[model samples]
Target: MSVDNRRVDASPSPAAPPPPDPGAAYAPGPARPPGPASRLRRFATPVGILAGVVGAFGYVATFDPNEPGHYPVCPLLGLTGVYCPGCGGLRSAYAFAHGDIGTAFGANAVAVVGYFLFAAVWVLWMVRAGRGKPLRIGLAPVYWWGIGALLLIFSVVRNLPFGSALAP
Candidate 1:
């Protein structure tokens, strides 16, 4: 066969690379992320929130809210005999502490809902902590408004004779 000089390649071999330099490597080393403890510090916000919740629950449990002088009086109650949104929270907590389900529900249906809410939030916090995700309260304004409206309705319904069973 006759030689074809035009087909000769000018580029280096595809399989071979340039020799490594005697100096520092140009390739970056893997970036090691922070460990759990360090990551926890970075996530101080969620930690603070969780601690506050635990402390609040502990305080409520240790000092029964039903007992007078443990907590400040509800301003709304002093102004009117009517049941405010938070009127029966203390009694409901006390009932919950003593395992009196009927009393708990009677003290405040809304508070019973609060108890479940607290439990769900606590569970989520624990789960997110395990996964190294921050506990974020991303509720929409509309959802918060819905909660407020629900409480207002709860307050009104509990005060009425029809919803007397809801009263403490």
Candidate 2:
């Protein structure tokens, strides 16, 4: 006897478990606007960060780094007679805090740039905090490596005769 080629059971599949109640699972939706207390709590971290930075700048502004006894010398400069990228950072900060932009740049242009960068980042962080949104600084590995390379190049150039301007 010839066997039937077609299958006998042609029933439709069961309905998919009512497409799992989206509400049941924790699906991220628009974040609830923070209340006054919650918003204040969020500001606490950014404010603390600002306070710490201001305190540091205040200390640097008060204590003169140009005085030999106040700040320690860069170990690299002391040992290898090489000017590190951060060799004049304290002096730069001192001049920057005192509103002497030219001297700050002369002390260390990169450090002056760093101060501005910090200010920009801090402002952005404060803005995000005020808006109840988390500030995210997600830099790629390449960017970090590039920064390292730039510092290295700056150090090397400052030590060279032609790059005397970069020296502290």
Q: Which stretches of candidate 1 lie over 4 Å from their true place?
A: 1-72
Off by over 4 Å in 2: 1-37
TM-score of 1: 0.64
- Tens-place lDDT per residue, model 2, 95-163, is 999999999998999999998998899899989988878889999999999999999999899999999
- Tens-digit lDDT track for model 1 on 1-168? 987678777997787666888796687768899666655564565568778866766667788877778888778777787878788787787777668878888888788888888779877876777677767989899999999899889889988999888777
| lDDT over C-alpha atoms for residue 67 of model 1 | 72
Candidate 2 global CA lDDT score: 0.90
Candidates in order have lDDT scores of 0.78, 0.90
Question: Which residue pairs show backbone clashes in model 2?
Answer: none
Which candidate's lDDT is highest? 2
